[model samples]
Target: MINNLFSAVSAAAAQEHFDELLRRPGLRIERIVSQGQASPTGFWYDQPQGEWVVLLSGSAGLRLAHEPSERVLSPGDFVEIPAHCRHRVEWTDTSAPTVWLAVHFDAV
Candidate 1:
């Protein structure tokens, strides 16, 4: 069950790619690759589970519903999004693919 995280980068469009790296009871891990894609306008992610994510490469912009300013992320930047927090991806680096590792689990 060994695989490279950067493998299989699609070049067809500016679509984000998500790969489920691991799934177990109460936990899930994913590898996300983004290239100039972002959440749809007026769209927000309200998840029941908390998520911790880190940018492994490239850059990105994130904004929480309650936050007035957007946070730009670079390589090695990480953030914790609590359960029920509304957030969205504002942008990702278009010059290169942005790689992210995310872990989702029950908060309680």
Candidate 2:
């Protein structure tokens, strides 16, 4: 089946939307749509899998534990986060939905 990444977007959203595009052993792909969402204060993500993610549209702020400042991501911006790297989503565009493509994979 053919699919479009920008499809299935809702103009009125109260929370972030997560769509799983593909999944297999040790790997997962997802499309995330965010509107004015951020990780709760004092909370962080520590995962056992590495993640490669890209900002497909809108904008966002990402903070990593080893980084001194948050990294601002615009459309097309991408990053590779290693396993066990504590990270958080600091901010996302509120006026428009922020789209993201993320690939998570366990170390080989």
lDDT of candidate 2 over 33-97, digit per residue (tens): 99899999999999999999999998999999999999999999999999999999999998888
Cα error, residue 12 of model 1, in Å, equals: 6.1
Worst 10 residues of 1 by lDDT: 6-15
Residue pair clashes in candidate 2: none
Instruction: Summarize candidate 1's per-residue lDDT along 21-96 as a digit string, tens digits.
Output: 9999989999999989999999999999999999998899999999998899999999999999999999999888
Q: Which one wins on TM-score? A: 2
Models 1 onward score TM values of: 0.93, 0.97
The TM-score obtained by model 1 is 0.93
Model 2 off-target regions past 4 Å? Answer: none
What is each predicted model's overall lDDT from 0 to 1? 0.92, 0.95
